[model samples]
Target: MVERLRGDWPALEHVLVIGEPSWDEFITTPWEDVRDPAVLPALRPDPNDVTLLIFTSGTTGEPKGVMHTHNTMVAANDPLPERLGTTPDSVFHMASTLAHLTGFLYGARLNVQNGATCVLQDVWDPVEFVDLVERHGITCTSAATPFLHDILRVPDLAERDLSSLTRFCCMGAPIPSAVVRQARERLPGLAVLGGWGQTEEGLVTLGIPGDPEDKIVETDGHPWPNMEVRVVDREGEVVPPRTEGALQVRGPFLFVGYAERLELTRELMVPADDGRGDWFDTGDLAHLDEDGYLRITGRTKDVIIRGGENVPVAYVENVLYEHPAVEAVAVVAVPDPRLQERACACVVLKPGASGFEFAEMQAHLAEKGVAKQYWPERLEVLDELPRTPSGKIQKFQLRAQVVDGPAG
Candidate 1:
C-alpha cells in the first residue's frame, strides 16, 4: 500500500502509519513516538483562517466543497449547548458519518464543546443503537428521519431499556408527521425533534425539547440565535406568513465559499445591500408561520408540476406517511406527454403489510382532506428508497425510474 501511494504521488515526503505494526517497516515515523509532548508544534491560527472543507451530498447535482473557518465553526457550535440544555454528565450517541456536516457539528464538536461524553458508531444499526443507549445512558443524538423509521421497526424495541434516551434530533429531510407520532407513542420519554439545514449554512433551525407536538412534527423549528431566515419571492421581496417561496438565510456561521469555485458561489448567493456577501439562497421552497417557525414545503427543483399546477411533494408525502402500512415514501415528478409532468408516489411498506394500490392511496388522501388534484396518479412499491449517505432520499433516481417506464 505504501509503494502504491508513493507511485501515485512521487512528491510525498513523509508517511506516518498507525494501528498495525506490520506496516512499520514501510513508514518513517512510529505512532508511539509522535505522542511525545516535546515533538508537537506550537501553532496558533487566526479566527478567519480556513479550517475545514466539507462536501455537499450531491442529491440535486454535483457536490461542491464548502469552506469553513475557525470563526464560522465557533459561531455554529456556540449556541448548541445552551439550546440543547447539555451538561457535563450528558452522553451523546452518534451514528452518522463524521464526513457529513450533521455528524461534524452535533456528533463531534458539540459534545467536545460541552465537555460531554460522545460515543461514536462507525455504522448505523437500530438494534446496536438501542444497546448503546442503554449501556451508555445516552442523553441525546441526531440523525435523519429514516433512522427514526428503522428504530421503530426493531422487533425488540418495546422490550429494550431506552429510558436513557431523551432527545432525537431528526435532520437532512422533511420528517413525516406519522413517524413523529409513532416515535412519541413507542418511546414516550423521547423528544423527537425536526430540523432543517444545509452544508452551506450550518444548522439554520431546530425544534427545542418543549415545542408543541404540531410544531415538532409539522414544522422545522425557529432559527438558531444570531441567525436570520426569510421567505422571499423571485424579486427578492419578503413574502407574507404561510406563503411558500424561496428560503434565504444570513448568519455568522455561514460558509466562506465553494472551494476554488468563486463564480459558482456568487451565483448561489445574494449580496447584501451593505456590500457584504451575507444572504445565501437556500434553493428550498418554504413558508414561515406567524410565530416565525419555518416549514420546508419542498426544494425549488424537486417540485412536481402537473397541468400547470404545482404539486406540494413534501406535503403529499407527509399525508401518505400517516397511512399505517407505509414504512417510507417518496413523491417524484414523472414525465407526462400531456401534462408536462405527473406525480408518482413510491412507497416502502412495513413488514407483512400488503395490498396497497393507487385507488387505496387516493381514498386515503381523500379521507385526510387532501385535494384530489394533488393525489398521486401512480403507486410503486419498493423494498427501500434510494438514499444518500446522509439519509436523504434521492428523488432524482425515482424520477429516472418513472421516466424509464417502470421497473420489472
Candidate 2:
C-alpha cells in the first residue's frame, strides 16, 4: 500500500489516507512542485469520463480500481435521498469506511447535494457515535448490520437519547428478524433497512421504510425505479419466482469495467436480450419471492471476511487442514465493529490427535504466508458436524448452532 501510494504521488494532486494504526511511513513533496487543486463542487467531464477510481474489495485477489463516471454515480444516488426521506434537515453519519461507495455517497455526496451537515468520525465508536447524533442532530446513519448489532449491545444503550436517528442502513450484512423487531422497539423512529449490492454494482436494491418485518429481515426489497434485476440459472435462463439462481442486475448504476482489468470486468458485466440492457452477475445464490423480494443465501466465493478485508476462506481452511488435529472445518463470518467480519473456525477434531490445540492451528496458519488476518477468534472443536443427505456441509445450520455467538 505504501509503495503504491508513493508511486502514484506524481499523478495525485491530493491524497488522503486514514487507518487506525499509526504509520511510520512519510511522504514529503515540495509545495512548489505539488499539484494540489482547489476543492470545488461541480466537475465537467467528457461523456465517458471517470469521476472516481474505486477499488474492489479484493475478495479474489488484489483489489482493482474500478472507474465510474458522474452520470453513473448520480444515477445511483439520484433516487436515494428522496426515496429515503432525507432532506436538507437530515444530518448523515457513516459508520463504515469512506472508501466504500455507499459511505462516499451517503456521507459525502448526499450532504453536499442536500446541504445537510455531515459528521465525520475516525472509527465506529458507539459511545462517541451516540453523542454525535445528539450533538449534530443527526437524523440518518449508514452502518453495516454488524455495527447495528454492536450498538444494541452497548451497556448504556437505553440510557442514551438516540432520538435523532431516523434510519440506519447497510448492505450484505443482514439483520435477523428478531434483531429488527428489537430495533423497532428500542429505537421507535429508526428504520432498519437492508440494502443489496456489491462494489462492482452500485445501489441495486433496498428494503424501504415501513416495510413488513418479515420482508425487511428475510429479503431485499423490490427494484427501484428504472432498475432492472432478475434471477437466472446456470445457463443464464431466467428462473421462476421461487427457484434459486444467480442474481443479475441491469441498471444505470452499473460500471463499464474495472480499470486495467478488462477480462475481469468482462466476466462481471454481460450482454442482455434487448441490447439496451447491461447485466452484471452478482455472484450470490438467491431466490426471489412472488413479490420480487430477493433473499441472499450463500456467496459463490470463498472469501473469508475477517472484519472488512476479504480473507480467502478456502485458502485459510486449507492452511488449517494441514494441522493433524483437524478432522473437518468450516470458517464463517462473525461480526465485529473493528473488522466488519471476524473469521471463526469450527472444527471436528481427529479422535486420537493430542496436543493439537486451537493455538497450535493458529500458529500453523501464521507460519504459512496465510495472513494471520484470516485466523478465527472463536474456534469450536466438536465431536462431529451435522451434514445433509448429499454429504454437503450446511453452513447456515452450523451458523445458527455455532457462529452467531457474542461478538469480540
Specify the highest-TM-score model's number: 1
- Candidate 2 lDDT over 1-408, as tens digits, reads 755787767665544454422221224444334544442224435656888888766443456787888878778878887668888778888766678776777777878877888887777677788888878888887766546756676778788888888888756444455557668877888888887776766778887888887788778666777788888988989999978777888788787778888898788876877876878887777788989887765566534565466665545565676565665677776666877677778777655777456677768877876766667777877666555321235566666666555432
Q: TM-score for all predictions?
A: 0.91, 0.67
Q: Which residues of candidate 1, in runs, are more than 4 Å off? A: 1-17, 20-43, 274-277
Cα lDDT, all candidates: 0.88, 0.71
Model 1 C-alpha lDDT per residue in residues 1-408, reported as the tens digit of each score:
887778889788866666556457646567457566564543457789989899998877778999999888889989877788878899998888999999998787888887889999888998898889989999899999988888988899899999989888898998888888888899999998888899988888999889888789879988999889999998999999999999999889899899999998889888778754568999899999998999999999899899999999999999999998888899888888999988889999888897588888989999999999999888898888888898988887767776786542
Candidate 2 backbone overlaps, count? 4
The clash count for each model shown is 0, 4
lDDT of 2: 0.71
Weakest 10 consecutive residues of candidate 2 by summed lDDT: 20-29
Best of the candidates, lDDT:
1
Candidate 1 versus the native: TM-score?
0.91
Model 2 misplaced stretches (Cα beyond 4 Å)? 1-43, 302-408
